[model samples]
Target: MQTPVHGSLLKPLQVNEAVGVWFHFSHSGSTALPHLPADILKWSKNYQNITYGVLDTPFQTVTTYANNSCLLLLDGRIDNLATLNDAYQISDPSVQSVVWYLYVTFGIKGFYRLKGRFTLVLYSVESEKTMLYRPYLSGFPLYYQSQEGGYTLSTNPLQLCDTKNSVTPLDKQRVAHYFTADPLKFSSHPFHSLSKLEPGEIVLMDAEGVEKIRQPVHEAFPKQAIPTQKDAIYRAYRRLIETAVSETLREDIDYGIMLSSGIDSATLAYHASKLLSKRGKKLIAYSWKLPNDAADESEKVKALCETLEIELKLLSAEGMGPFDEVGSMAYNPGSPVTNAFARLNRECYKLASRDGIKYLLNGNFGDMLFKYGQPKLTELWKERQFGQLLLALKRVSKKVIPAETQVRTPWLTDEVKSLRKEKTHSETGKTDYRYALCDFHEDYFGGERYLSGVYGITRLEPHRNSALVNFCLQLPQTLHS
Candidate 1:
């Protein structure tokens, strides 16, 4: 048995708790299991107390079911635990146990019933098949690489690379795409050999090879005719937001929100504070203050928090440079860190950790879902509604108009540009603005999940709730403004 060594070149950060799964399968009838890194092995020994073939991390669990015929590694919570518990009539069910039961009972199709941010890996010993599944809107990362006889799968791309060889080469084409294309739409990893599974993607591997199945984007964000009346839309929007916020709040644990001067975070803070206040609990709000008060929102955030009756904690970026801890932060996600706000984000997460907060709420993607304005103009142009287009342009800024922007790497060779595959509207269809937006921003969501995991914090985005997204997507473009 050749033990697959975890690639040391991409060293992971020293996180308080992290969840990852790594396994290699061979088509040559090898019964040997893949060896885990020393750190994971040691952590499992000290914390999980499991023997071989069973490893558990603080936020994830590995379970074997079906009389040991199947093994499952699960990360993230299951939102519909109550329904599953009632159906199975099991008390004190862990996410792993509930998922294992669903898989054994209904197979892969059962995953559709799940409604949460999670990634699952299931291996069948008897069938010699391995399945990697990530549900829709699941921000958790799952990567894989095909090898000689089979393939290796892992939550961290670095783990898939074999340390026997030199560090994996950077994918030049993907790097070019990162500079030329929209970062949110670019899904390629920096490493050439790694392949990330898209949200709602299922990879089935057998002796022959690997087959991928993806849930349609439209299905994930189905279109509905939301009444355009202002009052009706407002009522629906308010109800969805409130429900989403309520569902994300946990009674047993204290959670904090990343508040800003904008309405996005303020909305979350408002609802969260109200809900927690009912239970006699205080909601903590954390805001990042820019140095020298350069466009700082600290005062606004403070006022909002005060009005909401929640405690406000401000993290000053006074002496912190943009590239502070850039090296370590880049490796945390096992990919390139393109966001300039990475350093600031890491500092906020660090502050939350110091405050003994394990769950952090944010309104990161609320704007994309609720306040997107570009699509309104795009739809007008496509339909040849010049009159309406002009009126819309008057309401929107000149920046909303699409224009050719110079690539960051202006000297890129023609070859790299040719290799770039610009995203198409075919997958989402031209008219499905909501699906396109969600698909485009998938990477951002995954990135946040990775960064939060580094601090053992579960980052919740109530705005990304399926129902809320659907409702917001269906609202008329006028309402978005």
Candidate 2:
């Protein structure tokens, strides 16, 4: 195994206890680095690459291997270890060992089959190439910034900026998107210099510069005929859920779920409880009770947790407004906040972290799987499908539009007209799938990163798995209804 690089620079930057990593790649010998957080596992440098890494919450132990020809850094769980070990004809296996073996055996093709939330940085002397990648449905954040000869890569954007010689700037477009109700769904970074490595994307760097080696990570909606039978679709979904949840439950650590009254969280809690119970463990569920009437969803949460025999921890966050402690909360530099409940969310995570819970299974993006909020009515009207349009509007009036929103119908109409007068990226798509994509980027990727950073916890949203998402997308829209 490779050892951590020794020696300090002219001025080293300070690193937080939270999980983070930062590195600058240069062909000119070395790049100045920021002081690393206390949680980092390794900070190594060679002629071609300099890397900084921190142990991820659940995956705290990491083994680095380096020689004159290849350098490997891995910080997360690898689920298919046995298969990889068998394929490479090895007895002992670890994420680092598997990654090195796979690369030596299959080159870049080795990453495609990788399963888990991980950030990997590999440098090859023979090929003179540096590659960075994460899972298809990213479990963690990975970002990069191009430089003169090479580039800088980091798990934490703030750390990159904090480097002693760093000059990264805030990205205006990304900031604007974060403040808006509807943000663009595409991959973007909060900083002008850094870029988010989209799900399943892999980028290779050399002496010349950095370049995306393949198309964006993850598959798009399929164009083929989808499974038509509801029973078959349901069965497939069940299997996917079971597999996803099972793969995430680490036997050595205690895990919890973010339970709410919503179907998504309830479903996850039920299944997780059932699976863990079989292993002689009781699943702990966390629920936040806000002072606002709208935030009260305890009735269903209580019943579901009780039925599953799960340990429910009800947090009374009464009088804790969404905007409370906004300025004082753990601040991730350059991160944006659109929701007022960020404070409450942070409190829940802090509690979990304090209790030594490293993982929290969330049901984010679950509604998208069922086509919950399609702009179908708006599209129907735009298409001039008068008959369908009328039916859609009527259905919307009955089931979609809330009474509170109806009361401000005239105001809403005026606001819509005003919005049309302005150039907005949110107005790009008119389909449910498009909206889902946007929401996934905004709500899941952007928001979760800040939350995860503040509390030192990893949020696992298995519903956002690429396989599950592709399957749902392939099914007919009729099934969604």
Candidate 3:
């Protein structure tokens, strides 16, 4: 039978995997829950004792080996497949097949060989063991929990509650941090049972036991900007952006963009213009501003879109376009629980619905690849006075990094601390940011049994595109800064 594909699948291995739509609040850990959704249950029953993984949603992917010994799900885009695809000998153009083949080809090495930001899961049948993992350098959600010894993984909290005994109390410290306006976001949640996957590490479960491995992000990445010295970074960046654009536009649907006034979106739009010029596709740009909010700069976004000569749709704190606002959020699934990125997503969904566009093309992680978050910190570290850098990091965390946002909380914090402690470590084969990068990837970039399980949209992040990742990994910090 031909596999029907959405973005990802929520294959309910147990009864709780089939969650009722009534779950409103987020919970911690995996479970065996009551009120399983019929669709989930019915789908699970369709599989033989050997289960197959499928997408829980568009961004969430679930895939079980044909033998049923394993079940897996992934979130993110792979950009470097010309060779990997050739290695897998997969003629099929779909990402799933390439991924499955990669799994069959190299097992965990399969994970290492791939690039992009995601959170994923891999379960073993023989031992009923589950493995969770995240990569060192990434910007994706990865939270996991184990109850009754059975592990559950996701990019979001609510998904785990679909199981039994999954609902637990929230962590007040995390809540206080958020309410008090601390920058620790996402590392620790109010709910117990959930744990963020440390960056650049893999959580593995087997008959013997559960384990984790730290896979470093850079170093293995050659510090060159392009494959050839003859190529200018700007021109190469432009071509690569075009590649990212084409891959995203692979889906057959109307599309829109999340227009940030910054260079990231500006550059993305520049390449998009070249792509759409011939097709006469009027790229729809979505921008947002704050009316009563604390911080917002939608006017810059408006100005940028105008400069690019692209169609623009402006938004306010009030709401998105004419689409049934609430319904679209319901449809997005990644919203609400997804935090800051979630709000930005709402704008995308609203614009998509308004433009009659089925697909929304966002260059979300382009900033990460470009190191767009805090320009001066990296520079400060390079200039010495690491003390000031640490203080600045702490200062930023209080405001910029949320207790929950991976970069703001544990991932970035640990990285900063480690960098301070491990001056000689990089030479001895131990590095700080590189280590954190690995942990972040395995935990969040859709690794074996990782967390942050949010698979509810036809989501696309090409910045981590394998080719883009490969290229970025080879660049000097200056390029990223």
Candidate 4:
């Protein structure tokens, strides 16, 4: 058996904790990180102790820092030496080295300085204090259980691999929300234990239990600063590419990028190709050839890849008929998001497995991360950063009236904002954002336990880095300008 990377569940102790929240705390309990090693075949008894894994490179390092006192697991790469040096006094040396330094220097507070889409855990071995955090709106899928008799956290549900702690099932109200909720925020999952940490949240857990103390996602969504309309679009657009490209390549394994004809993938592919071209390595590109072969974007895809000089790996959509069939036949909790996207991910996993690649990047979560749905902008925009807000509005407009947006047109129309609900702090008995964030929790993002069970493949969405999102969120309304 391959050695387990992280310490085996020496004991999958039944810890009653809380689930699904967006929060942070002043004084909290300890946290833990249980990460499997890269090379371990299997862990000790019941997979209790890690047999394999290390953090030597950026590609496939599933480094788990544990003790009787703590546990931390991550799915991201940190790239801010100057920030690190200024914050923790760790100079530019290497990512792993800096991680150790930061760990030694700031313990929990240091996390704020971390810049990536990493799903992290802090378990207090002594206090049994536990807390989990995904990057602030970086958009890593963080499934958790915050109820009696069960409290577990995992990057994806599959990693936990225990039925006792898995989801039990859900009620009909959640199903109703899943099917008809406006904007369709609630997700569907058959197993009961599942819940996602809302974007821009810091969850705290302890003996008493877990509570997501709310915080603002952004002020009224108008967004932060910008100097000009053109600058807003340019910065937002560039930030997306810069984030997606630089961060995902941190895994300690051979990595690949998912490519397709869509602007999203093309955009990622465009930047990746440029980066890989500089190094002597060809950007290993993977694409899913649809089973029907009718919706083929082959010409556009091929032309782009060739122009960029990227090495391509084309996988058949039907190649994994057995795995797909098996997953569908037994469990697959009718994911409301998009199965085609999941299938694309599955195919990417197959590509990784077949070619011995450990890490692969895909364009998932970009829609939510970038808020790709343009129409929502009018409702979300805050006035503090009008210049930046206008640029985002323009990009959003392109999606709404693509042809018309191609030519210059008057972008700001208050009529749209007038039609939408105002995000007033005082009117709803809410002055700070935590209230609405919690409202999103109780009413929308969390509270619904769906698909808390089932095997989910590991996917790297580098663009969901916390630093990038916070930068976007914290920007003045016109920063994009």
Candidate 5:
């Protein structure tokens, strides 16, 4: 018997293409489709023609299974092919196929088992049910908008904004949160009509309406037994980092590393270079050179790249400031641009694209994963908690770095201040430090992912790997300190 395509199998796409998926589901069973902007329609048409159940671009591949009863759309790479293959007893599984198998076998709960940065959409035609999911700490963007008797979803939030209809209103609360919240939490979209799926969140839509589900904080970080010896702990940390870099490195696409003088990017570069060398490929490294700045690390970056036998591309951000390219940067992300260095990051991505790099790897979230607990230490010192401080110093470094001042929102109104107060209290009350760090990382990197997508470059951060995160969380508190 011939197997059905969409529910069980996946169709592959070219290496350089940008992947995105968009679809509309009408609860009222109306035949009329949502109005997609002409440019969006034209761009999507370049890769694949728009269909009733699927709207895809050449950059993305779509497949249907179970005799067209199910449709699966995936954006971003999966890092755990070997584990999934062994668990599911399948060989050579594509990302889409693995996701479909999991969904079929385990339902929505199967998504939690996934370890990577991805935004997935699974629609069941028979049941008229659509499920959208994003893993914890995933930077990939997924946006949806609900309308009268129906809803629309897309990887790009801009696609959901229909100019022919009423204007999309700004979400004042979200905008205020962007300015006042610490760690820059953004659980909602900047637009009132559209909503962004938070990290570790699932949205289910059907005839009954839309329901949002968030993973419990406690369940996200399960306890683990960690080695006590420093040497053993170091070995485990090294192994996890190596595995993360290895899995994210693909043979089909040319990749580059965003090198910095810091240990995080340097560590990733070292591992990535080693992996690519075995395949007879030289890794490319990109770093920002700020001329005339005493803090510039170009010299260090150059020396490290030389040692690794990697080609280094240094882009000068000499006179660049946070305000440069403000208009375009703000317009491109389809939301508020928070990262002060977004312009510089975009330039690096553009140059990488020109150099034929498909995937750009970075060491983001490294500090969070291997935290030093400096702020807590500083607080302990201030409170005269000498015993606790001594214990923390033994686990971490003896040196105590002064804590930075909180970001000030001078223009905050009374209402925004109240919102910020409530938000801060909730965030501070969380017991799982790892989960909170993941949330902060998601907010910090999500905008960067959107910015990189504009240049057709996919950003990969190995530090965000689930196994590595869980391992770090399980390590003895002293090790984390």
Candidate 6:
């Protein structure tokens, strides 16, 4: 089915159209023949009460399945297609096809069996029930708008508009929380009228309105016995890293990876090079060349690439003006740009697009998943652990990185202070390290994911594997070293 290209369509789609929306409009007798945004209406078809529109995005893997009565649209890649196809007795299953097979084979419980980053919409004419689902740690996004007569859903928020197709104002409260306070405070869409689907969530919408069906967190991160031996833990961790990287590599695409001197990116680059080499493919690595004012890690990045024998591409962040693109990007995801770092990130993607690179893997969030949490020294002090408190303070004070850019936001600063007043007793003065890491992870990854979509690049994070995150979280804080 043809789809509408909405406002703020990414320029990368002009060449490689990949991302798309599978919008389902269910109409009733009193609904007066529901309408979608003009873009959808232009290319959509109505079969019975449902109208489906698929928006084209760059480097998106979309699969569709229809057996007369049931229809499904899947947007995103399936890492385990071969395994799933064999288990389901199907040939070359797409992500959505696997979902359909499982749903048919094991009922709704089948969704839990699939892995990879994907968003799906399923409609069953027999049950007259339409379901929307997103996997845990989904790299894609989905938005929905529920109204009195009918509801609308799409992968692009721009498609979920009023009858006149006018856009709503920015959600200032949520914007403030994300910018100054807690980025995880609200996972909902930045638009006031629409809601964003959270990871590990499934929602069913019918004539009765929207009802959420929470899916069980996949055993990707099960509570396994932590290996006490450092060697055993390191070996297991290395295996996890290898497996996650191997699974995410797409044979059809020549993917590049983000490389820095940092352990996270460097580690992934090392493993990725080995795996890709086995198949006789040379991995290409990209590193940001920031202005001289910024810390230059080019020497370190070059050393790793040379050692690994991977082709290195350095994208310059010198001439990229930070303030100019802020307005446009703010509307892309309906969220404010956090800092100057976001500018560098966008520039990197733009450079990738110019060089014809569609997939870029990064090792972000590696610290959060590992035993990177610091002990709450203040909490220890309250219990009269004077020795531990001093040690904790020394550890925390050892390293401090200054902010890249500072903008004066008096109102935002005051409002955030007010919001923090409602913190729990444990969070009033001092907070646990895990809590801080969780907040940072949510904010950092959440914004990055959305922005990458805007730049028309599929950003992969093998390090964000659920099993890896769970294992790290289970480790003792003392093991953080």
Name the top TM-score candidate. Answer: 1
List the lowest-lDDT window of 10 residues for candidate 1: 46-55
Model 6 stretches astray by more than 4 angstroms: 1-18, 22-56, 79-101, 104-107, 162-190, 218-220, 252-254, 277-280, 289-303, 306-311, 315-338, 364-368, 371-458, 476-481
Clashes of each: 0, 7, 96, 81, 6, 4
Whose lDDT is greatest here? Answer: 5
Better of 3 and 4 by TM-score: 3
How many backbone overlaps does candidate 5 show?
Answer: 6
Once model 5 is optimally superposed onto the true structure by TM-score, how far is the C-alpha of residue 360 displaced, in angstroms?
Answer: 2.2
Error at 432, model 6, angstroms: 14
Superior candidate under lDDT, 1 versus 2: 1
lDDT of 5 by residue, 1-481 (tens): 1111221223343323333456667676654222322332222211121232111222333332222435566666556777998987875476656776787888887887887667777766556677888877663667678766567776645456643232222332232222221221333334447666766777888777778766654456555676776656656766888898887786655578776665456667777888888887778888888776664667877877777778999998878643323322222234443343455566677788899888888642223553433322122212343345335434543232222312111112243333221111222353222233423353442544344435566667777666676666545343333
Candidate 3 per-residue lDDT, tens place, 95-175, comes to: 545555666677755767665555555544444445555554453445556554444454544444442232222332221
TM-score of 2: 0.64
36, model 5: CA deviation in Å? 17
lDDT of 1 by residue, 400-454 (tens): 3222422111112343334322232234333222222332243343445445444
Work out candidate 4's RMSD over C-alphas.
12.1
Candidate 5: minimum summed lDDT over ten consecutive residues — where? 46-55
Ranking by TM-score: 1, 5, 2, 6, 3, 4
Q: How high a TM-score does candidate 1 get? A: 0.67
C-alpha RMSD by candidate, in order: 10.7, 11.0, 11.5, 12.1, 10.2, 11.2
TM-scores of the models, in the given order? 0.67, 0.64, 0.57, 0.53, 0.66, 0.64
Better of 3 and 4 by lDDT: 3
TM-score, predicted candidate 5 vs. hidden true structure: 0.66
Tens-place lDDT digits, model 2, residues 1-481 = 1123432321222323324455567765453333322112133332333444432222233334554455565545566788878876765475556776778787776786677667677776576677887665554566677665556776655544443232222342222223222222223433446666654556677666566533222233334444555445555666776777776776646777776654345556666777887887767878766666564666666766666677778788776555334422233333454444444455567788888887888742223343332232122112343334234334544453344441211112332233221111222232122111323443334345445554667677767566665665444332333
lDDT of model 4 at residue 320? 34
Q: Could you give candidate 6's per-residue lDDT for residues 100-176 as a string of tens digits?
A: 67887887657767777777777765566777777666545677776544667766554455313222223322222
